[model samples]
Target: MDEAARLGLVERYIAAYNRFDVDGMLALLAPGIRFENHAGGQLTAQADGIDGFRQLAEHAAALFREREQRVIARRSEAGRVVVEIAYRGVLAADIADGPKAGSVLEMTGRSEFAFADGKIGLIVDRS
Candidate 1:
């Protein structure tokens, strides 16, 4: 994809994620897309393909009462898009396996996206 299209894809993807629109997000991804999340320099989650990504997104949506991610900066080059992001969310409840409920979480992170056939083929998030 060209630079404009690549950037548009990333922006739309982030918008979908902020809205918790799993289908919308999936529509921008290629088949068998790979997604991974890293925190503190350790891999926290991994998903493969549409189904896997949907499951992960659902779990995330369930955990937060509301979530939003804003793009701080973005760069597209060589079939990859790198984005700096600011995230904020409110917890829905005390998570049995995670953070306490009613807590607000805010953080900054960066994500890298690799494109194939004009769709996202891989995503790596770091925070």
Candidate 2:
């Protein structure tokens, strides 16, 4: 896809994620997409292929009642799109790893997207 199209796709993906629309998010990915999630400067989770991505999304949605990602900055370059993100969510369950239930969680993060065959092939996220 062209740069504008690619960036538009990324925007759609982020919107889907915020809406907790797993299928919508998967529609923008390549069949064999790979995703890595990093937090606290360490690799925290990974999902391969569409099905694996579905599982990951569902798991995350279960923890947050309402999650939103605001794109602070985004740019597409060198076959990848990098986005600086501000995330906010309402905790739906006690986070054994981070916060308590009923708490409002906020964080700053970045996601780098790589494309292949005009679809997202890999996504690496850091926070």
Candidate 3:
């Protein structure tokens, strides 16, 4: 994808995440997309298709009560887009399971997204 298209996809993806629009976010991902959440202790999610993505999204919803993505910076080099995102949210009560109950946490992270065929292929997040 061109730089504009790549950046647009990234922006849209972030917007959907901020809105907690799982379906919308999934729409922007490739069938076999893979995302790595470094801050989440290096958790990796692979969406082989929309169904897989939906499942992941559902899990995400269960884990986070609220999620906000603040763009710190963005740049495109070659065919990859790197985004600096500040994340803040509360962990979902059910997902936290214990110590995190009623706890709100804030974190900052940088993610590098590589787009292919107008869909996200790889997302490496370093928080």
Error of 1 at 54 (Å): 0.9
The digit string of per-residue lDDT tens for model 2 on 6-114 reads: 8988999999999999889999999999999999989999999999999998999999889999999998779799999999999999977778888998899999999
Writing each residue's lDDT as its tens digit, candidate 1 over 65-108 gives: 88999999998767789999999999997977878988999999
Please report the TM-score between candidate 1 and the true structure: 0.95
Residue pairs clashing in model 3 are none
Candidate 3 global TM-score: 0.84
Instruction: Give per-model TM-scores.
Output: 0.95, 0.95, 0.84
In candidate 2, where is summed lDDT lowest over 10 consecutive residues? 94-103
State which candidate, 1 or 3, has the greater TM-score.
Answer: 1
**Candidate 1's C-alpha lDDT?**
0.92
* Candidate 1 residue-wise lDDT at 127: 97
Q: What is the C-alpha RMSD of each candidate to the true structure, in Å?
A: 1.2, 1.1, 2.3
- Candidate 2 scores a C-alpha RMSD against the true structure in Å of 1.1
Better-scoring candidate (TM-score), 2 or 3: 2
Q: List the pairs of residues colliding in candidate 1.
A: 93-101, 94-101
User: Model 1 Cα displacement at 31 (Å)?
Assistant: 0.7
The top-ranked prediction according to lDDT is 2
